[model samples]
Target: MHRFFISPQNIKENTVCIDQEEARHIEKVLRLTTGDIVVCFDGTGREYQVRLEGRENGILTGEIIHTGLRESEPALKLYLAQGIAKGEKMDTIIQKSVEIGVTAIYPVSCERSVVRLAGDKTEKKVHRWQTIAREACKQCRRNLIPEVMPVMNFTSLLEKIGDKPAIMLYENEDTNSLKALLQGEQFTGAKEIFILIGPEGGFSDSEVLAASRQGIVTASLGPRILRTETAGLVAASIILYEYGDLG
Candidate 1:
C-alpha cells in the first residue's frame, strides 16, 4: 500500500482528507480509485490504513479502517545544530538526517557560512527543508517528522540549547575524541542531545570558544575532516548508535 501524509486537521472521526499535493498525487499520478487501500500518517506517531472513498472538490476522502501507534521514534531526542550550507548540501543534510533518526535540525548561520537566507527567502528555504524532512520520514517509514527549525545565528543557538547536553564539533580539538566524550559520565542517561557542526569554512576560533563557554563540549571526529554536509550526519549516526538506537 502507498503511504501518504495527512495533516491532523484533515483527519477526524475515522475519516481522513487528503488535499493539496497529496490528493493530486493519488488522483492524477497514482490514479488510485475508490475502494483502493492506502496508509496515511499524521506525523504525530499515529498511522492509519484507509480505504479511499471518493474525491470531492479536489480532496480525497478515505475511511480509516485501522489506526495504531508507530514505534519508529528513537529513545533519545537528538538535535542537530548545523551551519547552513549551500542549497543542495543543506537539502541532502536535512533529508538524510531525518532518515538517520535525528529528532530535530537547527540551521545556524555561522561566520564561515556561504549561504545566507533572510526575510521571505529564509522562510521559503526553511519550508523547503521541512518538506524534504517530511518526504525523508515517509521514505524511512518514520511516523514522526523531524522539524527543521528556523536559521539561527551562532549566538542564538547557544541560548537555545539552555542547560541541555551538547557537543560542538571543532577541528582544532585534539584532546577529546567523540568516542571518549560520548562514553564519559557527562552523557549518561541523557534524555536529550545537541550536536553542532560548522559550515564549509568551519567555525572560527572565537565561535568555538563561545560555544564551549556556554557548556557545549568540544569534540573531534577523529583526525580526518569531513565536509559540512557529511559531518553532522556522521555525528548524528554515531550518537544514535552509541545510545543503542542504531546498528
Candidate 2:
C-alpha cells in the first residue's frame, strides 16, 4: 500500500484530510481515485489505514479504516552531528542517515569545514535539509522524520548537547572501537546518542581535545579513514545493528 505523512490536526475522528503537495501527488501524479487504499503517518508514531473518500479543491479526503502505533522505530535514539560537507555530499549523508534509522541530525561547522552558511542562507539550507529528511522518511517507511537542526560551530554544538552520551569518530583513535564501547553499556533507555563526524578535512587537534574533555569518547572505525559523508552513516549502521534495530 502507498503511504504518506500528514499532520495530526489533519486527522479528524475517523477521517484524514490530505492536502497540499501530497494531495497533488495523489490526485494528479498517482491518479489514485475514490476507494483506493493508502497508508498515512502523523510522524508521531501513529499510522492509519484509509481509503480515499473524495477530492475537493486540492484536498483528498479519506475514511480511516484502522489506526495503530508504528512498530518500526529503533530502540536507540541515534543523533548524527555531521560536519558540513560540500554540495550533494551533504544531501546524500542526510538521506542515508534517515534510512539507517538516525533519530536526528545536526550540521556542525568544524575548523576544517569547507562549506559555510550565514544569516538567511543558513536558514534556507537548514530548511532544505529538513525537506530531504522528510522525503527520505517517506521513501524508507520511517515512522518519524529525523530532525535537521540548523548549522552550528563545533563549540556551539558541544554546548547545546551538554552531557549527552556522544562519540566522536576519528581515524587516529586506537583504544576504543564502537562495538567494544557498547558491550556492557545499556543504551535501551538513552534518550539521545550523538555520533559526531568530521568534514572532508577532519576535525582539528584542538576540537578533538575539547570533545575528549567533555567526555565524548573518540572511537575508531577500523584503520581505514572514511570520507566525511561515509563516516556518520557507517557509525550509525553499526550503532543500529549492535543495539538490535538493524538486522
After the best TM-score superposition of candidate 2, give how far the Cα of residue 87 lies from its true spot, in angstroms.
Answer: 0.9
Off by over 4 Å in 2: 184-191
Q: All models: lDDT?
A: 0.92, 0.88
Which residue pairs collide in model 1, if any? Answer: none
True-structure lDDT of candidate 2:
0.88
Candidate 2: RMSD to truth: 1.8
What is residue 175's positional error in candidate 1, in angstroms? 1.7
Model 1, span 1-247: residue lDDT tens: 7899989999889999897798888888999999999999999899999999997776779999999998988999999999989859999999999999999999999999999889999999999999999899888999899999999999999999988999998888899998889999999888999999999999998898898788889999988999999999999999999999999
Measured against the true structure, the TM-scores of the candidates, in listed sequence, are 0.97, 0.93
lDDT of 2 by residue, 169-231 (tens): 988899898778766474445666899999999999999999999988888889798998899
Alpha carbon deviation, residue 26, candidate 2 (Å): 1.2
What's every prediction's RMSD, in angstroms? 1.0, 1.8
Clashes of 2: 0
Give me the displacement of residue 143 in model 2, in angstroms.
Answer: 1.4
